[model samples]
Target: MDRRKFIRNTAATSSLLTLGGLSLNSCDSPRNKHITILHTNDVHSHVDAFPNDHADFPGLGGLARRAGLVHSIRQENPNTLLFDAGDIFQGTPYFNFYGGELEFKLMSMLNYDATTIGNHDFDNGIDGLLAQMPYAKFNFLSANYDFSNTVLDGLTKPYKIYEKDGIKVGVYGLGIQLDGLVTKQLYKETVFINPFEVAIDMETKLKEVEKCDLVICLSHLGYEYNLEQKPDDLKLAKKTKHTDLIIGGHTHTFLDKPTVVTNGAGRDILVNQVGCFGVNLGRIDFYFNNETTVADGYTIKV
Candidate 1:
């Protein structure tokens, strides 16, 4: 199948797509490998669904409903991974009451593999953020945030590698600059490195040295920005090579489908972000065989 056509068709429709004319279930053969990536972003402590009378996401988006959706998807495909793009902190009164403990605990229950950091996460201060770390089961990844002088020094990893069904996946993280978005006293002493440079170095190491079959960047850098000088997911995709997908957050952009951007190497890179408040879930499926790799993605309403 033509790669461009496949992406177009998948983006146009939410129906299940076949891989090389075979259904996803049939791709379980030893010669073929299927991987499913489930993601959410900027949930912002929405543990409960909106009221039925609410104007926007009425009766939609609760942690329980999201969990059920994730559970069912996991049941369908064992070779699956869940991720978030940050801003899991601040939004509702929950954060005010618990100071992010509930958010971390519930996300841990949902089995999030990893996530980046958002500026709003510092609302409770760096030390406050660190205090709730004991409740989280997943690791935080941030390559550009130099936390050597802070309590988060050894807590967050620069990147992580995962292997599933013979496919090696390398995931890194990039966060937006927190200088103006977050107060200095909140994120004290955390140095912000250049994300573009960090991305190139990380992708090089992951693709050339680590030899990962798939490279992903869990980003809180927003989807796009009007200013060319500002770094965003679209710019990051066009600037780097080897990163297969960029799951983004911070802008709360609701994309029904993944935006396929041609990377510096001229390869297709999927950049996707579901809307905030747990109203949507992003799903991407990758099929790999001896000769080629194909991908399909769409958003699921929670």
Candidate 2:
């Protein structure tokens, strides 16, 4: 269960989205129910605050601030989901010294619902991640990385569904292609599959088989790339179907507001990515009904 629960005041901000002269935000009337999604990405082993004299970021990101923010969100909305998007390893002396033990332990203490594996996570080899798996209380969802022959095989799931207040929130993860990013020796036997195809399969099972009301993707594929390059969240949003929202990382992107895109079916799909090192906590509030009508939602800083 999610353990980072706190209590606070929640303000309601409502706006009507007209979809071809049809309203999507008001199927019934404004309701009391709500679900808040809190996420982080590319937190490259920044367990402690940056030094006071650091040039770029000073006294910024740390687990304490992030945990406090997440706790406040869960407090505001009891039904909340917290997630991390890859690169949980290899950034600071913490990972180099403790070998990811601190990462798993800290995340576990924060009550993260799930996370995906990034190429940097394979820095110590797949064995290292699996070695620290027992320290994590949450599951690591990876759909594109095939771990058939690696020590990580059969340890992770493709997706997970959570039923909170009659809301079926389905979340899955897509890792990046690690060919040039990671050393072959480190990620040995871990085959990288097509994210677009894998996303389709996971979406089908989540929407059709699992019958989730909302399907979210925890993606480590950066938000965008150079022209003609399609390995990014913006491209994934256009290429896939049934992906209601995409929370991404791996580019150290800090989006003040979430970007809205059109899906394969021409429906609204939102994409968001918070900067790395737990500097900011990404928050999106979705309020829906029995039919269509989700809006831009709201975003908050940690």
Candidate 3:
């Protein structure tokens, strides 16, 4: 079925998609490798759907719905990887009561592969974040934030490499500056590094040393900024080398399609972000062959 038609049909039903027998196999001699990436950003502790009478996104975007969607896709393609771009804390009443424990538990239940840290994740302060760290099953990656002097020193990694069905994917994380966004007491002793410098080093290490087939950045740097000095996904994509996809957050920008920009090496890289509050799920499919690799990304209304 056509992509738009499939989305339209799925949107008609409360169950969302009914993509039965969606073929992953093709007629080619050498079969293609398919990896499905399911992502969410700035979910902010929304465990339940919005009230049906609400102004925007009424009767949509609950963790249950998002889970079902992810489960269905994983069933179809077992090579699926789920990721979060951050701000997983401090939004709904769930966070207020449980203090981010519930959010980590649910993401663990959904088998999130990895996630980056957002400034809001520090709402409870460094010690508070460490207290809830044991609840998360997935690894936390942040290349730009230096936690050496903080309680989270060894708790998070700068990057992780995963091999799914013969394809090696190197994923790293970048957080926005915490100076103004987060209270100093909350993120005490955490050093904010230059994102551009970190991006260069991470890309070089991942692509050169690790020899990854793809390099993805889970960034909480927002999508783009009008100010030239501010580092956003757009600027990162253009300045970086050997990075493939940037899954972003912080601005809550709703991008129906991933934006492709040419990097410093004159190669096309993608930057994508779904709206905040778990309102949408981002899907990016990478098809790999011997000679080349290509990607197609789309957003699903959760």
Question: What TM-score does each of the candidates earn?
Answer: 0.91, 0.88, 0.90
Tens-place lDDT per residue, model 2, 1-302, is 11111111122343334532212212233344577888888889998877868787776788888888888778888899998999998889999898999999999999999998888989898788888899999989999999999888899988999877777889999999999998898888888898999999998898888877678999998899996655899999888778877999899887877777777865557788988887777877766544334344434544
Model 1, span 1-302: residue lDDT tens: 11232321222233244332212111222447788999999999999999999999989999999999999999999889999999999999999999999999999998989989999989999999999999999989999999999999899999999888887888999999999899999999999999999999998898888888788999999999999899999999999888888999999999988887767865567889998999999998897774445677888988
Q: Name model 2 segments beyond 4 Å from true.
A: 1-32, 227-229, 290-292, 295-299
All candidates in order of TM-score, best leading:
1, 3, 2
Those runs of model 3 whose alpha carbons end farther than 4 Å from true positions after fitting are: 1-31
List model 3 lDDT by residue over 1-302, tens digit each: 12311110112222222222111111122436888888999998999988898899888899999999999999999988999999999998889899899999999999999999999999989898899989999999999999999899999999999988877788999999999998999999999999989999998998888878778999999998999999999999999878888999999999897877768875567789999999899998877664334467889998
**Candidate 2 TM-score versus the reference:** 0.88
**Weakest ten-residue segment in model 3 by summed lDDT:** 4-13
What is candidate 3's CA lDDT for residue 87?
95
lDDT of each: 0.86, 0.79, 0.85
Model 1 earns a TM-score of 0.91
Candidate that scores best on TM-score? 1
Of candidates 2 and 1, the better by TM-score: 1
